[model samples]
Target chain A: MMRLRLVTALLASAAAFVAVSAHADNLVTKDRVGPADAPKSFTLRLTNDGPTSTDPVWAEGYQKLFSEFIQRHPGWRIDLERMSDNIGQEQARMLEQAKSGNGPDCAAVDSFVLALFKGANVLKPLDEYFTKEEVADLFPFIREGITGPDGKIYAWWWNTDLRVLYRNKEIVPDAPKDWAELKAAALASKEKGGEGVLFNGGRWEGTTFDWLANFWAQGGKLVDDKGKPIFAEGENREKFLKAVNYFKDLVDSGAAPKRVATIVNYDEFNAAAAAGTAALFIGGNWQYGQLKNTLEPEEFAKWTFSEIPGPTADQRSTGTGGWTFGAFSNDPAKVAMCAAVVKEIYAGPGNALQQQLPTAAALYGKYDVFKTEANETFAKALVNGQARPGVPIYPEISNQIQIMMGDVLSGTKTPEAALDAANTAVQAAFARL
Target chain B: MPTTTAAAMGAAQRRVAGPSLARRIEANPFTWLVPVAVMLGVFYLYPILDVFRLGLTNASLVGSDERYTIVTLQAMFENPALLDILKTTAVFTIASVVGQQAFGLAIALLVMRGERRKLKGMVALRTLVLVAWVIPGIANGLIWQMLFSEAPFGAINSVLRMMHVSPVAWLSDPNIAMLSAVISNVWRGTAFSMIVFYAALKAIDPTLYEAASVDGAGHLQKLRFITLPQLRAAILVNSILVTIQTLNTFDAIISLTGGGPGRATEVLSLFTFNTVFRNYDLAGGSVLSVLMLVISLVLALFYASFMPRREVSE
Candidate 1:
């Protein structure tokens, strides 16, 4: 009893000390972003993806961006939160909170899944901040991608990401011109004691993107000009079936490891690439910094990025995916401030400062990511990067596709059977909605 | 008239002396129950009721058309994957629980024997066995996942390659993935059964084993006659608890497999999680959750039936 009393008293005193210190600290700092004389004050919540201070160079770039924002808004205080996980899950969580009127003032949302939140009325329209012409100035496909069915822009697209083929130059010096050549190259590489390729064939959005490039390359469409499911019709079905079949063959034939179906994304691939284990890797461009840190200089230099190789030489296709700022607050004043901060962070000045691609057309050339030789290819390849199907139910469709691809790659199901299953599942999802 | 006079006198005395907390609680016995009742109503009752309510509706997270509907149930009934999913769950639970318990019993017996014989390294063996249990579930999953991962860096594959043996697809194959998950789970969970069985072993009367030995009973005969009967209650309790635990196990599968290689390792818990969190189908998730709760309840009832008629006077 005496020991308990002493511990309890200590805890109470510690709590009191912490409370007093916090209060004193808050009073002294006041989280200043502007001059004391500035009368107006707004807490603009800014969410962005960038490196931390430990990543000195990238972190310095982010600091420069934030400093620029502070200079632009003399009276506003910005609280920036860097989302540290898969931003898709973050977007879902943010939307879930918004439904209950419990959300941050602003957040970065994955552009592909933005429609899900927008359809649920979790995102506020940004018409008050961005003009119609300004929205139009965004790459037409991207603008259409972020626009809701109500024809309102709910998010400001930041720079987008493209899935591309990364290869070891020494192992397979020339980039394969087409799928047949790529397979041949991979097989030859395999003969020399190397894993031929690494790709995310797991059940995830990553798998969906992996399949999407192939589907689009083959001139297949999930939905037609009328926005109806058209794969059940004439040529699309055959093309889609072929794409899925080829995907299976890529794994089963040992061009890609059979274990590819279990790799979620980029986990083991990073280490494997740094160690020079795999000859080919298909992945997002975000890992450039990680590779630089982990890989030996020679190994890093041996790597190059190109458009995802296709079934035919002329078919250059890939999927563009990335994050954007969306306002989550319903308070008109807070929403207004969110829009201003978000716009500044992703467009004009902020775009020019950060390493990621800027969504704005005029600011595309000003990106730091474009300075690298590989990024130059990435930038040019962006033109071929198609946004995923812009629909509220796209996540469901993406899940079905992942399942279909996974079934073909990992299970006993034939490609045709898996495609039929996916079609039925997607149709069921739409019907339920 | 006397009652009125007595009541008046009591009221006058109460005005002079305020009721203490204990006195007030004694006067109104229900007051003592209020906090517990409120907690149950709020935390326990409300959520269960809400789940039932949600299960009756097509309650999706993304839409506002949440109405009284059985679409979720209809879909569940029509799903061709239901049987396969159920089979996966059953296989995972039975395989994990049975394997875990049997292994646990062996370890317990070994440890007890070690204690009697003063065996060297026995303590270290126990610590090694418990390492998986001591680590957090997610961390345990990661350790096993790396061990099972294919190719050059994976622990198992690395060893196999060293021996000039072909590396097996541990997690990628639909046939192998569930077994891999179960293996990881057994590694993490056996410690619980070990501790339980150890205590029961300790509680067994030493005289019984000594007398059996004196009567020239062999080791196996002693185990069958003396140890098995004495361990019946512990075995029943441990078996049921571990089975229920296995049925509810999701973390290892989630971290190691995420219920894939095309949903091959997808247990009921994982399926429910994918529906609720990934698909955002709240009603469907609720139905799955309710089904799980019903199974747990049945197990609980079964355990209750086997409970001792009187207090287990251990």
Candidate 2:
């Protein structure tokens, strides 16, 4: 009787353990998208904006597209990780993780830093996944930017953004076409008891990239054909100096407050707008989505964007930037699946929902949302948009430029002195590399 | 009876086993420290040694081309901004240490006076001061950033605007930005020094103050002659510790000014961080890390000099 009782207890324990294991499996598999009986199961670890993102609109759009993609691909699941809101930190973290071989299978990388990853040789090239016809559909700059030095596509440059002067239609009815008009309008807004124009004057890439448009409008190049930084060299130096001086004039004349030097992120610009303190600001085209999400409908409607004012009325340019996804999976099947995921998010309906201008020019024709007046303005702006060079040295150059801006704008150093110092630093870094 | 039983059992065990291995091992006090030594070696020594090792190599966090070399160290020292960064670090450390010590000592004296006089709400005051210290450094930075926001809507600027005064660039101007960072750091760190000084004050005999009062020594005189001299060791020790702490301040400054308005607040810690993470130069960052470790170690020796000496026997 004792033996029979012991045997029964052991049998009961084994049955309970099996039941718990089956329940655990059910818990893991529950709420999965697509067909449950699909033969293949693929899980993608992706780092991008997701449900936990601080920006609700961006998060919602990303989450929706990811779910839709998983539903389309049977037995697929995505483990989404929220990327860092700070661009520099995110890029650095991605590069560090890539070296460790423990990073996510796919990561949302800034387009300009794709070269750094390519140099690391951790990203799987996507040339075979994307066809020639598909590649040709991308913007010309993006087509060039996404391809590594070895003439292989390692990332999908899905969407791009343009920097522009966002103004309140009620306060500033007419767009400023030049630096002089911009300053005049900003001062006029200040006189009317509203804060003047604001831009990213803080120590970050935005300070360099947004202002680079002014230099580019004058046909200035940051680097030469050999990817050598020449922004502070002879002719380019003159243009760079002129551009920085204009920024100084704005701060010195109080058209834009000296405090504009504290603005680092677009969310700050949006916050100023939400407070109804800012009459005009320089921000990205996608800020329209952020503004819409942050402001009441009528308030958001009162705002619109225009080309970033150049040195003169006829000269026009704006800095273009965008996010890209670099696949790190070695398996070709996973790489192809990651490309499909990128397509579902960027090259298709996701672009329309996200409201970022898609890199594929045909998307405008496919999605009516791209034809809106605001997006059309952005599209026109893109004609003169210039993306930062996809070189490893560009980050260092951008850092030096950020410091130079802070110095010149804050009156700590003159534009000439700041540029010379910045040039020296960049040159030394370049030489070391 | 229980104690007697344990003692007898111990004696019997020792006699029977003739100081068995376990018994002999426990007999030496150093055996008790073996675990702690192992922990220190694994956690502290190994990582620090690795930092020095990496400092001698050309390693990158982003690339896999590490090699043993001195070029990274040379590059770090040769970099033009190194001098500026070091100078900024010195200014930041001095300002923060001075501010924390002064404010901490003042608050501690006030609280001690309150307690001696049987004043109400002394506990509340202590807790309130401690709240700042309890807040995480990053949160403190963010809180201060909101308060010092350059925008008109910012808490400080809003108050200034209400008085019809022109707004101040609290975080944009280079000098003012550094001052702002120092102020924020002092606010977050003062509580620590206050607690230390308060405890040291407790150890002072009350009769000293009573005798000083009878002799007609003023409050300032009592503080100078009695309190300060009594706290001399503590002040020195606290100074060294706070200096090291201030040197390692990265998160708060990073969140506050980002070492900016043009590298004005880029202390050694921020420089090391930016080099490793932002510049992707692990070896270069390691060199900076080693420099900081040397500084801390020097300060640690100074701290040790103030500690009470104890005798050891073989």
Candidate 3:
């Protein structure tokens, strides 16, 4: 009854908004434009790469949690604003807000972007807020990723989405264990009259994530601790070349679609999978949502996911990409509250969606998705999952690498030339750093 | 009427009143354009000058830091991809602008001719062509992607299957990516030129065509002589305007190809966006923006030089 009233109030305000003005500015947000009703209100406005989903349960959870927090500290409010879903735009906004020394107490920063925030000195270290035990409970690599060189934790990751091998059980009914087997499976799936294997081969950071995951699996190093290009010299070049060559081979082979170069991001890949055209999609595990949401029951049953196979046996690897809640403030009082909010939303057993592997670390087995054998395999894969280079210059490095991946995938440049060219560019980027 | 002469009375009144506001405005036309000139200076010229200032420094989208450097400009010139990207931008701008003008004029002429003949479908056809133009860039990209994406599932592929022709990779291969982008863009952008040309064609005196027809001139000859001559102003204006628009085409290409198939269609605008926003290099992006400004200015001067000068009637 309470939830229904809130929903009704929201809908009524929305209708009023539409009636009052046909303008889009008023249409998007339910929050007030300026000033709080009370003096003690902490306007913890936030923005992210995606809008807050309207899942009532998830929202209700946050609302209840927020009300409780407000009740405990009397006369306080949280005013969150969403800027954009674009990473680069959001990063700029976050930095600008940080420079102003106000805005949301903090925001949910993507894992790859923590380095940028840290570099900009916008991130406030979380050392004083969270206890040592809480810190230890988090994934070590994640901890390492956020921790600056000065032993200060700049951010805490909320979730992770890894590149997993998804295939149709109806065609080629079995999962591939290694790189060779995965290729053979692709060939077999093609033979079965399916559209065969598909990768997120489009030009963007998505391509870089997919490419780097495979490279790590093949024992190719992207950078050292100092964020220098490792493949710029000697034997590493040949190893890195193999990764692009694999993409080239995938396209060259009849297994992958001739138009694999245009496969793009998850949505494009998901459409093919939903249409039953693409039998295999090597992409993020988050596609589970689309599979469940978009596909028919019978179709959903045929789809299953497994580890992204490595070049050698027992050499599984995947890359974890997800968003994290990070704060940027110099004030200790605001900093403390930021930590509390981050922990309350992302830490421990709280919201079901937030409890997932991508958002949080603990209580994975408790969730049905986590309990599944496939996800159990994903969890195991996470143990060896490669984290992206957490450095200020990583975005520059990734940009050049994405271009190289595009070059190799589109057959504009051979793998050797493309990879070599990317190495030189990356070397230049590192030199700047 | 009681005055020594009405002309003498009017001349005395004119001398007493000096010049009326309207007469003064008519005497110096550019005087009325002062607000517009000021607005252009503030909104347009200032930003270009600001970009130059930024290009000379290292001020970025981050914290209050005392950092200014000329190394960004040096590196931009030194970058190997600069030449190739500029070449791509040139190809894209020229092809897209020329294509937009040609298709737009043809569509406009066809529609105008049809309208003159009292054709029923002309209105609907004009409205239908604008569907591509009116749709948002992101939506247009998505719609085109669904149509041209891959084989079997894509709309084009389904048609290809019917015709027994092999599927075309619309956005994948570098050999075809720029052409694909141009085609997609031409569909969305040509309507602007069409609208302009349609209005221009409508404004032309019909008696000129009638005169040409009576002189034993064919339809093609009339078009070549009267139509072409009259439309040159629209053509020049649209060419410069569309050239800038196409050169600065970021959203459509970003949403569709993303300067991809390995930078095959990486125009300067997209490259600048990627440099600043994506790569987090503000100084470098400013230099590129300055370069884009120079390119547009050159085109502006070139187009303005050919613009017909108004005769001083006074």
Candidate 4:
């Protein structure tokens, strides 16, 4: 009787195993798309690439939009995965996965990486799905951010960003319009017992961006028209050296904290600004939104934005920044669908206008201007805004720039020595390109 | 002569028949090995083989080329940032291991020497030490990070201000970041070494100590000779374990430093992670991983070969 019971149990287990195997085999893969008229079910994954806690309002806004998307697209499911504020790392991971031929059908990628992936043929060109008229309707800077060297669009801009000088109104009634005035303000703030100005002087990619914008304002070009790096051996070299020297002197004179060597991310510096410890900070516009959420309305009112001070009185410029959504599938139909989705999400009439209006309102609220006024100023500034050179060797160039800046900041190398070293490295990097 | 040869062969057969080799091992040895063997196969050998396979493929996010080459290794050597990372890793590992062992052994000796009146509290204190070890590594890093925050709101900075002292940039300064990581790790890991030493102390025969005491030996003298000699085995094992743990530690450093302030706290493992995950240079990451694996294997082999063997009495 015991043997018979054991046999019965074994047979039952085997039958259950077979049933499970069949069920698993029948499970639909995420990449499988059904016909339009057929019973369709799908899951879409989204990554926010920012901290969820600091921006609860923005997270909730995206969540609501996702729910609305699910309702609009019947028989489809979506799962949004929020990553911490490390968009560069996320883009690198997505790019790696795409090279392996198995990646997310769509991913939120930074504008810097969009060009790299497009050059590598890992991104699907979106020109076929969106017409030129529709593309032209986007903010020109946003459109330019996603355009490739071949003049094909590989991604859609989700949001746009630009660098602005954030100042404490109590410390300085008027924002400085040039570098010399800014330096004076910093010194004055320090003498008055506040951290004068805080730039991310740490060795990271952003530091290079901070340096290059100033260098460009001083008329320093990294590469000449012949595509050769020229910062070391010409009249332009002196201007680069002078700008860097001034920056170093400011740090050395206690206009900024000695701990500038340690600050890795803008958030840390921004925290100091919010606490009213720092007098001025150069940061992105999203930071204003972050400050709004973190500080009381009264504390928020202490801050305002202006253009970064230029080399001379006349050459002020903001550095343009944005993020892009790249499609990662080789399947034509899937690629087409992804492109359609990006357009629907970013550039559709209501969505595009919605994105613009909120950002403009947020900027105006913080800068103490009307939304219309802020929008017009922003539109005019876009013409003068400079994007980082879209070179494949940008990472290598960035590293060199950071190292050279580190030497100057540490007072180990003069500006001429540092810029010369950086120029050599830049030349090498471009040679690789 | 033939009869003599047959007798000799019978004697040899009798020796073999007394017990088969397998039966002798089974009769005299432990049974815990069956589960251990299964676990080692599943967790260690299987994953090692997977890593070996991954190392061979040129699989990257940017290309479909699966052909293996020395390109990754070349990249590893070519990257200039690796020198600073190696220095940081060495400093962190050495400091953490030495600190944990010294503090752990000292505490173990104190508990062992204390009078019975103090024994309960000492045991309770040891239990408290275990709490830091029991907490997840990332959580420990986060707790320490909060303690080390440079802002006036931070615990360390607040205390400094109350004492009329200037606050230090504990995480931001390159000179202090690795040391701070070591302190956090030592706090979490010392408990393990302490427990091992405690067990070793308990295992030492009470008669040996009593005999030494009868000879009019002082407490320090007894510890120097009897306790130290008896605890050598435990010390060796604990050292090996701590070394391996310290060398491979990732979560603590990553959560604390993120290898920032210009790669000031980056270790080999973090460098490997950045290479593979951040830079998509899988080949270079694999080479670094392989180098780390080889170093670990050599250390393990040296420990196994040099460890003093136990003897049996007749």
DockQ of each: 0.40, 0.53, 0.51, 0.20
Q: Quote the lDDT for A407 in model 4.
A: 61
Interface RMSD of each: 1.7, 1.6, 2.1, 3.7
The candidate, 2 or 3, that scores higher on lDDT is: 2
Report the CA-based lDDT of candidate 4 relative to the real structure.
0.68
Error of 3 at A128 (Å): 2.5
Per residue, candidate 2 scores C-alpha lDDT tens digits across A274-362 of 99999899999988978998999999888988888888999998999887888887767777877887877666665776677898888
- CAPRI grade of model 2: medium
TM-score, each model?
Answer: 0.87, 0.89, 0.88, 0.78
Which runs of model 1 end up more than 4 angstroms from their true locations? A1-64, A67-89, A131-134, A224-233, A348-354, B1-30, B118-128, B303-314
Please give the TM-score that candidate 3 achieves against the real structure: 0.88
**lDDT by candidate, in order shown:** 0.77, 0.84, 0.76, 0.68
> Taking the tens digit of each residue's C-alpha lDDT, what string does model 1 give over B113-232?
999898898888788888767888777877888899885788999999999999988988888888899899998899888888888999999999999989999989988999878888
Q: Give lDDT tens digits, candidate 4, residues A183-268.
A: 88988887767777888666566777766778778667766655466666687778778777767877888776656655556786
Number of backbone collisions per candidate, in order?
Answer: 1, 0, 6, 2
lDDT (10s digit) by residue, model 3, range A236-272: 6776777777777877876677676776678877888
Query: How would the docking of model 3 be graded?
Result: medium
Q: Rank the models by DockQ, top first.
A: 2, 3, 1, 4
CA lDDT for candidate 1? 0.77
Per-model TM-score (chain A alone): 0.83, 0.87, 0.86, 0.79
Estimate, for each residue in B196-243, the C-alpha lDDT of model 2 and write its tens digit: 999999999999999999999998999999999889878988998899
lDDT of 2 at B295: 82
Better TM-score candidate (1, 4): 1
**Model 4 clash pairs?**
A96-B61, A99-B61
Residue A290, model 4: lDDT of: 71
